[model samples]
Target: MAAGGGSASDPLFPPRAFSPQGRACLALGSPDGRVRAWDTQSGRLRHEYVPSAHLSATCTCLAWATGRPTKEGPQRKKRKSEAAESVEECDLLAIGTTVGSILLYSIVKGELQSKLTGGHDSKVNCVRWHQDNGCLYSCSEDKHIVEWGSQTCKVKCKWKGDSGGVSCLCVSPDGKMLLSAGRTIKLWDLETKEVYRQFTGHSTAVSSLMFITERPSSESQPFDGITGLYFLSGAVHDRLLSVWQVRSERKEKSAVISFTLTEAPIYVDLAVSENKEEPVKLAVVCRDGQLHIFEYILNGHCKKTITSTSIVQIATSGKDDGSVPTPIPILAVAFCSDKQSLLLVYGNTLQPVIERVSLKTSEPHICLVRDIQKNLTLKMKTPILKVKTPVVKSETKVLVPGIPGHSASVKSGSSGTPVSEGKRKPGDKEISIEEQLGAMDIDSMKAVRRGGLPQTDSFAVLLVQGLESNDKNILNKVFNTRKEKLIKNTVARLPVYSIVPLLHELTTRLQGHPFSALLMVRWLKAVFVLHASYLSTLPDLVPQLGTLYQLMENRVKSLQKLSRLHGKLYLLITQISASETRQDVTDVNQTAKLVYEEESSDEESEDEMMERDSDDNWEEEEEREEQDVSADKEINGDSDPDPGEESEEEEE
Candidate 1:
């Protein structure tokens, strides 16, 4: 129901890897140098397995074994039944690590059963288990894809066909073909150990590859017999995703569909609905903070597009009852039997943020779900453990010298006055400024303090800090000031009720942080100016003002940074002025003065002359326009042109 509900849980430690059974998520971080299991639904810890032999490394990828043993003998039937029972019974996790090692863990026993090492020269990036055979496949930055036997963790085959490092690897549902995507898509015949075909449509490196399966024809038919597998590959530079169909003979591949996106996806994972009833949908996450869902139609067409913030991985969990198949006789429905989809998003920032989107609903809520059991309980216990706690640290009030303080004045040229210390008896509480800031829970404030501006002072201090930081090129002070002005103008033109809550939030949560507060104040001022200037022409101002607001809301932390604030503010003001909102003339002039002051400090005489020449060109354009207007009026008095004739001439 809410925007971030599904992401309310804690992020998976060291990220996560999804199995075919999406209900169980695997966390491969070195929590005591071991791989752990996490239940996705309940956010509970399932198990933890540590292979004592494998130390000083982190697991990077994981896959579940789905293959059956191919041994033949008199004990075949009993062995098959026993294998089926065992395979269906216990969950298996295959882990790939930075050391180019693969470890197979038994979920029921919570122990490592088998380990494979040195197959890859570099870090393994992806791992997948063959559906029909007890075999494991992995791709690494070493530019190799190595297949291993499930029991021994022995390399069955190794394919090094890519020029660049292999980024992703996938196996066909039938286990006949393996696909490795890197600079291009390379297809390998698992049975023959031959590189059959190479597809090269991507301009950039390929990040992921998936095989979409067709539906079974009847209950009696085997899954591989009924369904045909097709490949979907995602590329980075071109921002192009291509769908290819393998010929029935399995010798060649044909490109059936392709689509371009605004951003190049870094890591693309796919999920297919298990219900044979619904249209095919593909979820893609791009590097440019966008999550896209594409619905496939007949004749190789992608009909719908939905976009969101940066999504890193996507996986499906079986089927649901709501996806009824339309009877339009389109493409064959191939469902993965999984009911839901898990999307791992890196968020707008580097902080890893994962979101689970339910295909059952168009508007999905994002919650920060934690895979680790400890975090899940912590999340649940956080609100219920109602305990009144007192601040344990006393606040320190610093009094600068020459500020006319009643006491604690420092001599000239000496270090500023020391903060007054107070002693509290046992049980008396005190709080620090850091603790107070933490309680506010404002994301931008956290960023600002982390960037070295922990103390808050008056507006003058803010301005000075902004100017000083501009030297580091971290803050664009002029643009930020202009942006703040725009926000202020927009808010002023809004109804009183609309502005009150924002102002209240600024005064309360943002207390003591005068720099951030001043920025907000300036934004409100700019919004007011824009609204007033375009009050009679609201239609034209609406879109531009909306863009400005959206930019501000999205870049909250960057706006709080004093260095870049002024530059961003000035740019916003210029944009607004260009949009016919002729307001804040004096403020604009002051901002210009500040910019000149900053830029003038570093310029030769020739550079200054060039800058002056550009200004003169602008002035000359305005003067020439005035002269042309006067001349046109004099000519019109001498000879008036008929309106109809002018219209006809223009049309002609």
Candidate 2:
């Protein structure tokens, strides 16, 4: 019931729920520990239970219970006064508080009926009532689950299930089995006063639990004695809902099925669909201000397969134009009495309201092709024919560069050959590769050398030629295609006079091919090292170095921004991971891994902070010394021995 973590817009008070008897009224809790019941149809307040200032505490959980009849008698007509008294006796609301006390308030009287205290030592996280037995079960941060008799307001049974404190509890309809979840999930047998079953596989603390029973055809009838023992457990941190089947015998393996959700769910409610085929529907109120409804079919073996899902976007604080909208987290969700609508409670501490949403939508129907005919055949009735058409001669006009004033017209045949050449005889000579290479010019030779160099000397030859050549296209091609492992050695082979053009080429291409920017940076460092003495005092290189400096400044700024964004995403992912499956101390046999958790509420002592500062300063000094040594090596033109390839295949 922690609702996990949220921003300022998230509701601060406890979550709400619809009444179990009729669900006509929705119960909402306030920050001041008051309970308000609102009519689901009219959206009006029906009852408000306000406590005294001394007994006031933030409401943490709410549960509704109808008072059981003291005795059974034959049905007979009653006067108006007797019927009104009966209604007042039946409606009761139980509110759990941060002080670990439970307040039972009569809805008809709009006042507290009884206060049950000294049951839990810590904050109560959940409270559930068993209508059949008139017993209330409550779990708290003190790691204990207490069952109190409603009439006596005293603890009937007390037991501990988890060491990390229980956050949620669910009572079986028959009051035989109890479900408790916190760091782990455990099932208890209320009658035997012992553990019934212990379920595993949830990597996070369970937030809510509900037994999925087969709803009867008539709403007036009670659940067919829990026709199915399947139940759902939701974990907010991991955004997962797992369905577990409780086996009647201890030896049978209980199957666990899980469904992943897009956002963390604060509350989940199940509704029985009117359609017989799709008998069950699930409603989930998520932290992103959206309502998700899942309609599924439950098989005989206790397996549920989702047939369809609908997502309703709830308007919180957004514009119609759809900009970046602020999310107002939903606090709770429940199905109305008719099961044709849903009620949602959302908003911040200042002003929270309940809204009703219709459940009806266009039902999807399958198109079935039922008719089938054997021996079906299709025959062509018309004969096909081939036709020959006359060919059209196309003329192309070419502008001759040598004769600028005159254009030449050329006619081509259907076979795509020039009409002037006519048809070539089979005996005519064909061109050879040797003739083509021999007739090539200087520019043609450069094009062949780009991709035609032998594997052995391709990188070395290209690097030297690219550096010496004035054309940037050749240099860029060489830089982009050269093997990364040979960069240091190949740059070392460049002549001292080619350093100026190499710097210019690297700087120019840095902006054009951003993917290769890091490779270019490495090349620049290598060039500066190889020709440090020859190029350091040359004033001709100053303008190029200034441009390179500016480019590097921009690159550094972009990387810094990316690093900050990555840190924020890492923080959120780690928080979720910690909440899901974290331990106070790892076992000795466990493998070492990175575990991220929130810092404690207590601030660091002055001595500890000072020590941390000193350590950081020492690390900074060591890094500076390392950088200085590397710079000295570069100046002395030292080459790394057997440097690994950096995968420079990325080219744009």
Name the runs in model 1 displaced over 4 angstroms: 1-15, 26-34, 48-56, 67-89, 215-228, 236-238, 248-254, 259-278, 286-291, 298-652
Model 2 TM: 0.48
True lDDT of residue 214, candidate 2: 53
Worst 10 residues of 2 by lDDT: 1-10
* Model 2: CA > 4 A from native: 1-13, 53-56, 68-89, 215-227, 249-255, 272-277, 300-308, 316-331, 345-355, 360-652
Each candidate structure's TM-score, on Cα atoms with residue i matched to residue i, is: 0.43, 0.48
Candidate 2 local lDDT, 1-652, one digit each (tens): 1122221112453457677655667777766566678776576777777777423466778887877544548878889998865664466788787778888888766678899998998778888888687889999989999989998999998888688889888877566888899877788888877887778767776777887765555667655343456678887576667777776554233445655577777778887544336657777766565666776665544354343366665443445798654555566667776777766666542334567766554433211111112243578799889765434345544222222123333434344543334345476554455543332222435535554423544555676676666656666666765555577887777776677877877888787866887678778878877788878767356675888889889878899899999999999999988976766656576765887667773666889989999999999999999999999988888846445543333331
Q: Taking the tens digit of each residue's C-alpha lDDT, what string does model 1 give over 1-652?
A: 0000001011222324444443344343442356556554454556767665445455665666543334466753467677654554366777776668877777655677777886987777777776666678888888788888776767777878588888777777666877888877877888887876778777665656777776544666666521255677776466677777665455444466775666664434445544455555665544443455555542343433333322222222323776432211000011233534544434211122234444443544332323311222223444567555333223333333321222332121112222233343465445556654443334554445556333453333343344444332322332244455444443544453333333333334234454665565564455355445444443334553554455456557565685577878999989978766555344434344334356655665887789999999999999999999879888779544576787778898
**Number of the top-ranking candidate, with lDDT as the measure:** 2
Number of backbone collisions per candidate: 70, 2
